[model samples]
Target: MTVEYTDCITLSEETAELAEKELRENEATRRHGLQQVRDWIVKNPRIVHCRDDENFLLRFLRAKKFSAPMAEEALERYLLLRQSWAAAFNNMDCTLPNMKHLIDAGYLFAAPGRDKYGRRWIIARPGVFDPHKFTNEDMCRIHGLVYETLLEDSESQVRGFVHFADGAGVSFPHITLFTPKEAVRIVKNGERTLPMRHKQVYGINVHPSLKYVLDFGLSLISDKIRKRVKIYSSMEEASDEIDTNMLPKEYGGVIPMSEMIEKFKEELMAMRAKLLSHDEMKVRLEMFSEGARVGSVTALKQGSALTCGGRTLDTTLCGSFRKLEVD
Candidate 1:
């Protein structure tokens, strides 16, 4: 017995029809709308090279409910945000040394089963969160793994993400590793960049000692997120909201965390090459195109450098799309 997610962010029949029409290019609106966005990106000197994949364009459109200009706004900000946090989001190397530590921590995983609405469940238990073992960059890198792999599905995007956050045994030490600044960055990225809908966030096993910390951290996020946040007072209360049968063994579920981790690892290994291919498509100063201007898109800004964690990132329009290396 569990509490059903009342507010699953679902794609309506009308939305499905619209997505089919616009994303598939079967209708005039898709062509006109996508072309307009492509034109905008080409004109903007800030945008170096644009990957105009029909599916990519369609994602931004679905994110904004098929509003062309709005999708453009979302896409532009997404690109800029990706550029700004390149250290946290770039180069596509998942075999890094820290990845093992991240996996061993066992803080986050995609549940093997889906909910009644077909929403993918992502569980994060910060009780095992060790800042000494991993930096925020590693967190973001693993987050990229989750983002680029698990939530990349169109059906899941349409159905939405069912988030479960367990704060049991999560003391001040665990929460502090994730700073307010980092919190804000994650919140902003989720709001502005990611093209997926958040169905609901179920907060379980939160003890009283950690209440203030949790509330304070949540305060830094948006009202949209706050509204979706449902803090359960106890395990029974949480079980009222979440299906225990679909959960891992630690949380009184059928599967084990170790099994889930193995499954995720296998999926990551299979996607390794495709992830590398994304390197060229993602925004980078090294891959910008100077002469690929299509229409009136001509607002080029001088190159700028950003330093984060002692690493400097430079961004400028180079020449054009370089050959994508897909291994």
Candidate 2:
């Protein structure tokens, strides 16, 4: 029979006593270590069932596997201490983490040290490491989302009204205008017609109460246009003053209303023109020849009851008109 050989492990009495004494003396440290581990586990509950702690212990053992048994035991204790520290902090709160809170707690510091691989560790405060910081792109996304939500909620307040028609003999629909600048092209059901492009016509007669709402909404979208928009009492009066002739040809301005109808015309010729055009083109042209004085013309039926005074003639003659081609 052959005796089996086995390795023997033994601890000296002095060594055992020293270990017990160290454990007793550092009881607070041990407790703190355990708490840290518990906090980490609480904070990262997903990692509780993971092999993280086991992996860390394995790594430590590989590096010091040939060390004394006591050294290995100390390493294990250190890992458990760190885990306790993390767990203690993790259990404090389940709400979203705040970098400011961590910094205020003095748990983090900008210390310079070597990492596990002897590489320089550029330590930074928790604020720098926080992943939830609002970036420029994030802010833009939030702004766009909010704007869309508001637009959808206020859809009823942004309605449109039709005011003018080009009558160009085209298949296009009559040009409609909205008091507010917001307008969109929509197709009717079962229709294959091309979508129409409608332009905003200024100086439209809007209800006083609606006017305030439109002004506020326009200001929210575009302050420049909102400031420039003007509201008038009547659409016809507004159209009559705005000199379509003064505008560039590209803007649909051609002849001035003042020059369109003759001051004195034979009844026969006036009747013939009206019959040929199927619409009366006569307009009474008012001119203020003297300084800020009222003037009137009754020869043409257009301005029979109207009066013009100080700078009104010029102001009316240079107004811009928006031409909308609706379909």
**Which candidate gets the maximum TM-score versus the true structure?**
1
Clashing pairs in 1: 3-240, 3-241, 43-297, 43-298, 45-299, 289-319, 289-320, 290-319
TM-score of each: 0.73, 0.16
Error of 2 at 10 (Å): 97
Badly placed stretches (over 4 Å) of model 1 are 1-32, 281-327
The TM-score obtained by model 2 is 0.16
State how far residue 49 of model 2 sits from its true place (Å). 46
How do the residues 1-327 of candidate 1 rate in per-residue lDDT, one tens digit apiece?
A: 221111232354644554565344234655666676777667554556666765566567766666666676567556655666667776545577776656656777688757777778888876776767667777777777676676445556556687888877677666666666567556656765677777788888898987787777678656887899999887777786678876778777888889987887776777777666665554443433322111112222223333334454442332221121211
lDDT of 2 by residue, 20-108 (tens): 34233122433334334334333321122322232222222222222223223333223222233222212211122442233332212
Per-residue lDDT for 227 in model 1? 90
